[model samples]
Target: MIKFDKVTKRYPGGHEALRSVTFEIAKGELVYITGHSGAGKSTLLKLIAAIERPTTGTVLLNNQNIGTLRRAALPYIRRNFGMIFQDHKLLYDRSAFDNVALPLAIDGVAGREAGKRVRAALDKVGLLNREKAMPIALSGGEQQRLAIARAIVSRPAVLVADEPTGNLDSNYAHDIMALFRSFNEVGVTVLVATHDAGNAEGRLLHLDHGALTEGVPA
Candidate 1:
C-alpha cells in the first residue's frame, strides 16, 4: 500500500540519491530491492518509511502523501512501520529482551502484554532463551536476529529492512530470509534492500545509478 511517483531525493549538497524513481509495494507482498552500492536502494527504503522526504514528486502510503506530512503527523505514520537498519541497532548495555521491549515501552503498552509480545517475537527469531544476553556476547548472526526481534515485537503491518543480511554468512542469510518469508505469509508487507536478491520470493526491483533499471514496479 505504498506508491512512489517520479520521486527524486536530493541531499543538501545537491547529490541526487534517487532519480525519478517510481514503484509500488502492495500490502502483504515481499519485495526485494537489488542494486550495487550507491544505487539508491537505501534511499528508496528511507523514502518509503518517510525518514527522508522526496525533493520532487510524491510518496504515497495508503493514498496519503507521507513525504509532505507535517512534523506532528510523522510519528503516527511511522508507527505502522518496523525498520531494520544495516547495522543491528541494539543497546549493548541492555539485555536482548530490553532492546525488544523498548518500542513497547515507548508506546505505553502495559508490562504484562508487552512481555508476552517480546517473548513471542524473540521466539520467532529463535532467540527466546537469549533474552537476557547482552549484545556484545552474541554472535553477529544472533545480533542481527535480535535486531529483527526488536523490530517485529511491535507487530507493525509493514517491515522495511536495509541490508538486514549484510553481515551474515550464506546460511545465516538464508535463515534470515526465511524469517522474513514467514512474516510475509502472515500478511506483513516486507521490503528488503540487499546486494544478493538471489531467487528471492516476491517482486524484484533493481536500481542503477539511482534509477530503476529492471524489475516490475508493484
Candidate 2:
C-alpha cells in the first residue's frame, strides 16, 4: 500500500535525512521502523504522510504519487492514514470522547454518529468508562490509549505510530503493542517507529543515516 522509490530528503541546512530510500509495504502489513535518534524514521513517515516532500525520487500511497499531491489535496491524502505520537498531544480542556470525536467532526460526521464512533474507538482502546474524563485527569497510559483511540476513530486504512511507548512502563508499553496487534489483525496497516527493541515480533526495518537496511523477520 506504500512505496518509496529512490527517495531522498535534505533539510535546508544540507543535512540529508533520507538517502535514496526504497521500500514497499503491502496492504495490511505491520512493520517496525527501528533506528537511533536522527536516523530518519520520522522523516520517512512525514514523507509518506505528505508533511514533508521528498527532495528526490517518489513516495506513493495506494499507488498515488504523494510527492506530487496538490496542497489542497493534502488533507484528503492524510484522511486515509492515522498517526500516533509519543507526546499524546491531547487537548487538556476537552473530554476524551470529544478529543476522539474531533476528526470525525472535521469529516462532517453528525453529532449522533460521531458520538457512537468515538465511543466504539474508546472501547476498543479499553477507555470506554473514562470517556468523560479530561486528559490531565487520566494516567499516562490512559492518555496514550486515548490518543490511540483518537487516531483510529476515523477507521483509517493505515496507522503510523512514532515512539508510542517512549513514556510508558513495560506493562503499559506491552498493552499498547497488544492494542496495535489487535488493530492489525483486523486489517489496519501498522507501522511503528520505536527505539525500544524488547521482544517485538513484527517485521523490522532498520534505518541508519537515512538509508533503509533489509527487514528482519521475527
Candidate 3:
C-alpha cells in the first residue's frame, strides 16, 4: 500500500510540482492518476517510487516513510515495485527474453531460475513466442508488452505505469489496460498515470495544477 500525507514538492526555482496532495492507495487496488500536462501526475508517482522526495510531508510505502529511507535502502525498497513507462525503455540490442531476464540477472538469480521466470513473464504478456525477437523487430504494441514482461519478471508487489498506453492505438491501449486489470484481479496493486480520461478505471484520482481535484470518481 502507498500513502501520501499532505505532500508538497517544490523545485529550486520556486516552482511547486505538487502542493499539499494527500491520498492513500490500498493494497490490491487499481487506481488511475489522471491529469493534463504539468499537472504533477508524474511527480506523484516518482514520490511513491522514492525517485523524488517530498519537500514537505511524507510518502509512505507499506507504512515506511520512503522519503526518510537511507540511500542504501532504496534499491531494496524499489524491488517491490515494477515500473513501466510510456517509451517502453527496451534494450534494442537485446532480445525480448534477455530484456525480461535483466532484472533477475541484476538480482543475481541463477540462470535456470531466471529463465523460468522470464518465460513465465513473457507468457503472461502473450510474448513467449517472440522471446528471441529483437525489440526493433517488434511492433509498437509488442515492444510495450515486452516492457511489461520485463517489469513483472521480478514479481514485484506493486505495478506502477506512467502513460503506459500513450503511444499505442486505441485497440492496443485497451488491450494493455485489460492486461493490467488481469494483474490486479490476481492481487498485484496497480497504479497508472495517464492524461487520457478514457483510461480511467477502478478508482480514479484527478489532479489540477498540482492539486487533487473534486472530480475524483466515487
List the RMSD of every prediction in angstroms: 1.2, 1.9, 1.7
Cα TM-score of candidate 2: 0.96
- Candidate 3 lDDT over 41-160, as tens digits, reads 888888888888899999999899987889999888887889897677889998999999888987788678889999999999999999999999999999999999988999989999
Clashing pairs in 2: none
State which candidate, 1 or 2, has the greater TM-score.
Answer: 1
What TM-score fits each model? 0.97, 0.96, 0.95
Q: Where does candidate 3 have its weakest 10-residue lDDT segment?
A: 209-218
Residue range 19-41, candidate 2, lDDT tens digits: 99888899899999988878998
Best by TM-score: 1
Cα lDDT tens digits, model 1, 1-218, are 99999999999999998989888878998999999989999999888887888999899999999766898898778778898998877899999999999989877886799999999999999999999899999999999999999889899999999999997999999999999999999999999999888768888899998999886454
Give the residue spans of candidate 1 off by over 4 A: 216-218
Q: If both were scored by lDDT, which would come out higher, candidate 1 or candidate 2?
A: 1
